[model samples]
Target: MAGVILPRFYGCYNCRKRVALHDDIVNKDFVAGYRKRAYLFSHVMNVEAGNKTDRRLLSGVHMVADVHCGDCGVVLGWRYEKVYQEAQKYKESKTVLAKYKIVKLDYW
Candidate 1:
């Protein structure tokens, strides 16, 4: 976290939806398929929208939903709603963008 960091972009699961900028990534380890990585950006270009679900996960208690590519409907990661677990409650307002579901775009 030092000098002149350039920006990097990432796309959605199926479509070329620019979902994340380099700095928007919350995890230190920017490894693909990183566990429960969240981002502030969603599909940049046109990809469909307003598709969300309120569902639970793990023990089928905490409410979670897959944040998919609206155009292609590929599962991104998840959005936490109501978490039953004590640790997961903090993620209630965050969206986890699946690393494997996105492709890193080259810097222009």
Candidate 2:
């Protein structure tokens, strides 16, 4: 027999609903040198403008595994490419995408 550990909840900012965390696709070695780090970068749109909304744009996709709260479905930190690139100019640094907030649904 095999046992699996999974997240219990996922909060969606768009709909403001807390959904179950299923359909997980884990990439163990998404980032190099950062053994525990993973990347989840998907295109998303900014729909806050009502009509004439901007199209989906490229979001940087790099995250550390330690910042996620499986029980509450919150992400403490994340790193995006734009921020990463900027940080790279100075040195190798990871940008803090979000700090202790519900992981936005569109972020995936």
Candidate 3:
């Protein structure tokens, strides 16, 4: 599936609401020199409620694809993070969006 292009969508895990695909806040790079744009979605574990004592926590963002289904308008899945080395290469190259393909849609 190196050359295959998958569809994308932005789906809310809470209400299962989906919206049209949108631009991602950051760019990602995949294996074999593939690249795509993606956004961050905070997961339940990532969120921390305030406690009695003053304390801060480090939470990671759950990345999701910025896509929306055209027919039904449901978000497919959260975006996955790409390899660090590959992503760095893409960031340095500064290429066009057409250079890479949308490989997966993590629906479910």
lDDT by residue (1-108, candidate 1, tens digit) is 579767787887577777667665554332224245445342233333333555544435656555667667777666555666786565565565656677887853
- Rank the candidate models, highest lDDT first: 1, 2, 3
Models 1 onward score TM values of 0.58, 0.21, 0.21
Displacement of residue 6 (Cα, Å) in model 2 is: 20
Give candidate 3's error at residue 101 in angstroms. Answer: 26
Per-residue error at 95 for model 2, in Å? 11
Roughly what TM-score does model 1 have, to 2 decimal places? Answer: 0.58
TM-score for candidate 3, please give it: 0.21
How well is each residue in 31-78 modelled by candidate 2, as lDDT tens digits? 323333433323112111111212222334322232233344444333
Q: Which residue ranges in model 3 land beyond 4 Å of their true spot?
A: 23-105
RMSD of each candidate relative to the true structure = 5.3, 12.0, 13.6
Candidate 2: regions farther than 4 A off: 1-29, 32-34, 44-73, 76-81, 84-108
lDDT of 3 at 55: 16
